[model samples]
Target: MRNTAKITTAVLAAGALTLGLTACGSDNDNAGADAPLTVAATPTPQGEILTYVKDNLATKAGLELEVREFTDYVTPDTAVQQGEVDANYFQHQPYLDDFNKENGTDIVAVPDATVHLEPLGVYSHGVKKLTDLKKGATIALPNDTTNEARALKLLETNGVIKLKSGVGYEATPKDIASNPKNLQFKELEAAQLPRSLGDVDAAVINGNYALEADLSPAEDALVAESPKDNPYGNFLAVKKGDEDDPRVRKLAELLTSPEVKKFIQDKYDGAVVAAF
Candidate 1:
């Protein structure tokens, strides 16, 4: 299961930092018979999936695949846009779309693999359950366009609020038609939502940042985005014309391999489902 959304974005400053392979050297070309093709990936599932390839698949493919690790969401897209990397295995289509729209660049998905589906979960601090909320409890949500709508939709589905008669993917918190609990919506930066958890009654958080804060989606989240009901499935991002790149195809193949699938099953348990 997956959850995704399209969001319009505001511009953020990014320095064009070139990430070279510390061990593999500058061999991005298809020039040498044994030269490596470099790909950039985010820390957890994407980079973890690439580690499997680095350890197992690259040798058999007659290629040495180098992966650069990234933490900030902005840098990978910026790196990809500058042609500093051949592929990136971090964002979903929505984030990619926003990054392109904001930056006026054309990074595309080379291989469409929803390798990991991290949900938006609402967890409480003082209250053990949602039923414990007072009439005017405050619940924080991500302020960004895509995630804010997602948080509201989740709240609506859980009977926490009521939205207008008919609204689609682009709906925002302003679309909420009812709020019986008088739940104050505290909108914060997605990256900061988890840190604010201790102060609020409950907070809706993205899974990556949750995990970064040492909260596992399978464990600490009170209620989360179930693949059974979400759209933002993460993917492999690449430059627009390079979808057919051989290394991209192979990397996607290896990621979806049974070994990787079982690894996800064993590691993340139910938190990060492998939608490969």
Candidate 2:
């Protein structure tokens, strides 16, 4: 689940300072090959899944895993790019691409044996279904590039709104081609959408945030992204040159193990789907 923590100027300054020190030889690349691989993850499925591997699977596979939980999106990638952590496991490819383009960071995904798709779900306390949404209903949406577009697509898929043809992941509220219900849009930070439910008619929430809020998408989402052919599955990621590190390979293997697939299926009960 995402937290509403302010990414303050001080935090950014501290991150820059850490980047400088990391370059002078304190990074994981210089550590012993068997050193614990620290992974930064969002708290819900990513952290919980890593913790499972750490407690029950890492030792037999000859891996030392340390899971560091982050409540916001920026820090995890920032921490990994700066070598403050060995890798991170919380973002989809689209978001990662956007981040790299915007921040001038060179993070890349570690190919997993399988991918896990966290479907963006539309949730509401006021309505039981999308049809129940009234005209002029206020809906909360993610303000970020990838997710806001993804959220809008979900609505379009459910016929809540229609988007311009060929406008897919790049679609924004401005791309909406039709809104028969005349719904109102309230765009907020992705991390803040879950909490905005009480203030709006409904909210389009990221799957991880929905889980952190204890909302089961399978049961509660008015609608969610379909796993079939979905390109947004989240994967373990690392700084460009670190992809081949032994520790990183171990964690990636564990993440795709049979036990992990079963854990996800049983725990999330379809809220989270394994890509392999």
Candidate 3:
């Protein structure tokens, strides 16, 4: 009962954004109350979570939902911005903020619609512990802005490295003030980090990608971000003015409902934590 279709970067780059505009038309047409609200999401937890809503909760709540899956992070926002999809559910605020500022896109979160938290994790095949990594060992990180800063923060938290004072979420390797082991870093796209584990000594991976790769954040991660007061809760987001669309509102309500909470807890265990 999963209503999902996968779109690759090639297709997106080949005028898929324009195609979305042609198909969905303007924001008003896309948000028509009777129409299905298409959402762009990454395949792991976001698409799966939305699929669960489509098959179960959405109908009961009088919503028609369609899910389109994308592997890369950038396309989903662009898809939403271009009206390729009505909304997206794959990113946290830091990422969204950076994307909007960088691309001049006006995507905004659906209010109070924070759904889940996929704790960022550090994983390795060669090392049993952070201290086990040898001098000059290379660790791969997500190359995008927010995630890279997040990865750096994770490393700093575990004492693997130290950043310059007050670098905050924008911290990068260039901010690293200390590296006791002189650990080298390989910056790759977030999707590629799990695959890079075999090549690098270790990698800090996003929770969703870790789940997609079948690495349990609860059991497999050497270290992970604590969810307490975490600002990275994944949520539903739409281009600027779609917040009040009836369909978006209904989906937002359903996304943060008790049913979705139970589904996340039961299906993902500690790998995905319900944020509502």
Question: Highest lDDT, which number?
Answer: 3
Looking at model 1, residue 196 earns an lDDT score of 94
Better of 1 and 3 by lDDT: 3
Give model 3's TM-score versus the native structure: 0.92
Q: Which candidate ranks first by TM-score, i.e. highest?
A: 3
lDDT of 1 by residue, 1-276 (tens): 122211111111121133432323222344344445567766666677777777877678766677777655776776666666667787766677767787887888765555778877888778766767899889998776667777888888878888898876556768889988888889887767888988888998887777778888778876777787457887777777766666677767777788878887887777778876
TM-scores of the candidates in the order shown: 0.81, 0.90, 0.92
lDDT of 1 at 272: 75
Worst 10-residue stretch by lDDT in candidate 3? 1-10
Clashes of each: 8, 0, 0
Q: TM-score for model 1?
A: 0.81
- Lowest summed-lDDT stretch of 10 residues in model 2? 4-13
**How high is the lDDT of residue 217 in model 2?**
83
Candidate 3 lDDT tens digits, 121-147: 999999889999999999999999999
What's every prediction's RMSD, in angstroms?
7.6, 4.5, 4.5
Show model 3 residue runs off by greater than 4 Å. Answer: 1-26
lDDT against the true structure, each candidate: 0.71, 0.83, 0.87
